[model samples]
Target: MTTCGDGRLTCDEETIDTIRERVLSDVSARAPFDAVTGNEDRVSDGAVSGDARATKTDREVAVSVTSLSKRFGDGADAVTAVDDVSFDAETGSIVGLLGPNGAGKTTLIKSVLGMVLPDEGTVEIRGIDVYDRPREAYTHVDAMLEGARNDYWRLTVRENLRYFATISGVDPDSVRDRHDRLLAQLGLAEKADVPVRDLSRGMKQKVSLASVLAGGATVVFLDEPTLGLDIESSRTLQRELRRLVEEEDLTVILSSHDMDVVETVCDRVLIMSAGKIIADDTVDSLLRETGLHCVQITSTDLDAQIVSTLRGQFDTFSANAREAGYQIEVTTDSDGLYALLALLRTSDVTLGRVRTVEPDLEDVFVDLTAGDRTPGER
Candidate 1:
């Protein structure tokens, strides 16, 4: 056994795996409400549900943001970074924020993190206003931002965890058992003594994650957790995060451009654009609400008027100019496809190819953010 700085007699990395297995076994046997993850099949193969998790026992509100708004610059130069965004995330659920580059995803998360103050609205942790009660709010929250900046570069993985947990007011001795288990689960047992700066980007990120999970924080904010990792590394980290939420009873808010991570890990999704919340709901519900499936349409001498007519009916209509005419992909279902075909024949256009294709999250994302106005115009 190795002695930690806080005088805890804990088995160091050499024997952590064995201890972790015993700990996890005990932890996993709890009741459904107390199990590693309460939501059934919410995550599969490192992907969130296309439909989102269907059920979970009710839990108290973990984080609440009300009518939050922020702006930069002044007068004509003023640009709203976050526009009246509001949402509530319950304990043990993962909520995601997705949007294009300037869609205020970062600003919204920053406001919640207290990294940037919101010009309007309130942020609360377990109903305590974060802006008004930062010290108290921080006790229940921790975030792993991009770049693993939450961690100290020169500190060893074990050292970082001990430091962060203590500074967050968690007695190291009380959580020493968990601290070892986290190191094991993150695959850092062999390198627990290695300085964080000596590790790979993915390893450093995992170390950062270890810090977050060890704090006993009621809420966790992970900003682009998968940003710089490779495929396998990404998958590994994603799996760990899923387990952390389920087993730890921790609420999570995720911000990512990677829809796969968001869809796989999040119980609910909030889509941002133009400094405002344009969509908020489950991923499956959002896909269903789009009322769309793929139907490809190819034509010879495709009349411009017919394309215009189709556009009026279908929210998504993309046409590729061809030598003879054009090929169009329309987002609709079987019944609508038939109607479109009938309409095309009525217009006397020579159709080439028409068929259905699978739907993708990208499709839904495109549809949700589709608008003609450039960022400057808005």
Candidate 2:
């Protein structure tokens, strides 16, 4: 295996070959693409022609985990990485898995993907038990871990896609149209024939994503998918993921430290802490339930005395000097907002501008995981 600069590991060519041989041996009797393309009556602009997106009622449970747990070492040195966690991901939706460092996010994901066996509980992919029927469970699943590491640097962009497709029990010729469409949708058509080693870091990341989808897998796991992308490239990739989920009925389990991306793209988020899920809800619901509000007040009258007074009263008080005046921000509840306003009025502080700051996913995450020491992982 090779390690990327970001400290994530990717499979080497020898490891890739081993995995391919194992998959081929296990799924030798699997049917071809024709047998999988049952939805031949629908069409979408970015998806294969005649492949309609599945409706909510028609969507099946793509992944399920029940009471999963994993631990490392023995006796007094035992460390639990995943603690009886359970969740289900439906087809045509993206579920975000988030946590701070050493929060068991990696171990939980590895257990779900069958890379590491859990000490307890079970995992099912497409209703097939992963441990009981590894071949069948993995047939509809694919993963792109550690950003751009999933692609072969020595191979051309198109060749990498075809190679992955072949390993997934697919015929490259059969998915030729799909590959073309993927390349076009990801802005990689121009680089299709170019070697991956010759592309920019961001382009290589996109190639990794395209190769993962080339196999036409129904369920995919992505780790830091937009690591090297610029703002525009990140937005483009987000749009493509939404399109794939809506048009091709793909299921995605996305794990990333970029809270902005998760907030924008995920249907639901699962937050882990200390080997346990601390929060699970839609982004909007989590924001609403936080009951935290931030207010920013700009005033030339915000002298050092007033700023110091406000800091003493509010735990989340912060002040920055602006061109025209001093801007002060305070995070409080609804009741505290009234108290703050009353204090300002009594201090004879004339506010030039008052704005309510919207709380985002990052704020919520930090609030939830505060005071937790970094632990776990053997």
Candidate 3:
């Protein structure tokens, strides 16, 4: 037993596991909802089973939120956190949620998870209303929040997996094979018996993720899943997540500040600002729709006069001194590009190299929310 920071006596891991088993058993006896089983069949020999695989052509809605609104405080002091937000996450896909600080992303996520009671709106999981049928609706759901600390420190990696599965109303034994697969995929197999506290921060993050999927949750929420990981470890987790989504019909709602991860992994992105979703579309579509293009030009003949002339003509023009030449970047459309080239020709500027700058998700995010000053829930 250990005394927690709050001065509460906490039972040992064995004792806690026992209590969890009893609670699950009692809940099963009451039959509020059928326990999930046969998850081992979802994967076989390190591959997704044919019967469990989901494709984009036949995807189903995994999560649906409509007109969700939440406000804090009351009267004059009241602040609306989520304002009539609505979206759907499809099965076998990763949806990225993004927002600047105080943009209501956190409030929207909490409301959907039933962690916060919204003043209005509806949340549904797997076609079941979350507020009206939470027990049934949550059977297909799991979440890993706060990154590495989401798992038990005292429990071993495998123990954490089994514990989460058991508490989620699944028989741990029934999914032992699936747990083994998760361990291997996440590179935790060798440390299966090591306590989570004994592992590195990145490894602990992986354990938290494995625990989320241990119970065969079809819809999962991951926040900064690669928070403490190195480049290779982050890539490994990203590949595993995509594989799970494509192979096992998993639906993921991923929230992260890493725009590269969001662009590479998520099939679609929802950007929130001022307590509402301001943008909803695929990364490619969003980029194209921004209607902005950047071009970089390197020239040896770009003197102060030429630079000032270009800057005066193009508001987005920026120039940097380089050993070989002056490198300048300017935002322009096709017509503007032609005009820029013609201006450089008239100035007799000798160009060294020119290339197009690709705009990423972060660029689009900033462009959209650049003018937003409305404060909202963080």
TM-score of every candidate relative to the true structure: 0.71, 0.80, 0.80
- RMSD (CA, Å), each prediction: 10.9, 6.5, 5.1
Question: TM-score of model 1 relative to the true fold?
Answer: 0.71
Clashing pairs in 1: 36-246, 36-247, 37-246, 47-264, 48-263, 48-264, 51-284
- C-alpha displacement of 224 in model 1, angstroms? 0.5
Q: Clash totals for all models, in order?
A: 7, 1, 0
Residue-level lDDT tens digits of model 2 in 1-378? 889999998997789768755654544344344333333321222232332335667777888999999999899988888899999999889999999888889999999889999999999987889999887678678899888889878778988887777667676666779889889988999999898989999999999999998878788999999999999999999999998888778899999999999999999999998889999899999999988899889998888888888889875778998775689988876887899999999989898999999978887887787655685432
As for candidate 3, its clashing pairs are none
Question: On residues 1-378, what C-alpha lDDT tens digit does candidate 3 reach at each position?
Answer: 789999999887789878756754553343212354433443232223454445678787889999999999999998887899999999889999998888898989888999999999999987889899887677678898799887878767887887777667565766779889889888999999998999999999999999998877788999999999999888989999998888777899999999999999999999998888999999999999987778899998888788888889874678998775589998765677889999999999888899999867876887787666665345
Give the residue spans of candidate 2 off by over 4 A. 1-55, 301-319, 335-350, 373-378
> Candidate 2, after superposition: displacement of residue 278 in Å?
1.9
In terms of TM-score, how similar is model 2 to the real structure?
A: 0.80
The 0-to-1 C-alpha lDDT of every candidate, in the order given, reads 0.75, 0.83, 0.83
